[model samples]
Target: MYGSQLWNITSLKVRMVYTQWRKADRQVLSVSYMTNCDLLPLIAYNMPLESILDCKYISFYKFIATSANKFVSYTAKSKIFDYTSTLSKNMAHLMHKYELDIYEIVSLSKYKVKDHSYYK
Candidate 1:
């Protein structure tokens, strides 16, 4: 069940990033390349599954923290839909449960995708 949840979360991250990339004015090739770079280590790493799960979750949280506000605002203004506060509360609860500080998670999430070839 845990493995399945991890996979779902990872898939969510990929979908989210791809959606953003498509909407971005940046070069598609460059964005695709960068996304691949960010994802390859997670695909190839040999770390314990639990560690990988945590890393992915932290990365997702960082992504949400950085990007969700703009999206939430736009949707709220245009569609009268607003879920950002609820999402933030849920994230905070998860962070507390995991004993993870937001700043630390954001910092460490950046390096989680580095080469893990030595683990192979």
Candidate 2:
């Protein structure tokens, strides 16, 4: 469903949480995507949201964004949860730290939705 495929995605959401065992904490998240077509990739992507954001336990670059255009707003059919618990007090006090809260991906659409759902 990446390129030039018709998708009837009605809604999408995620359910996830962190579990602490001993001194280390790990997160377990369940991802469920509802679409007319099978959504294996979508489900797989959502499952790692928590782990991707973990700096101490797991390290990876992460981005989150909404799909929006000049005339329309896109709701987040996907969600992400960071499950590494809070940063240490020493790291939190660092003055020369950087953080990025959002990122965007571009998609081109050949067709427009003219249904009442688009306005809603």
Tens-place lDDT per residue, model 2, 13-44, is 11122222101221122332232112332433
Every model's Cα RMSD, please? 13.0, 17.7
TM-score, structure 2 vs. true: 0.15
**Candidate 1 per-residue lDDT over residues 1-120, each given as its tens digit:** 243323433245645754564434235333343454444334444443434544555555556555668985444333212334533443454456566565555555356432221232
* Residue 117 displacement (Å), model 1: 17
Instruction: TM-score each candidate.
Output: 0.35, 0.15
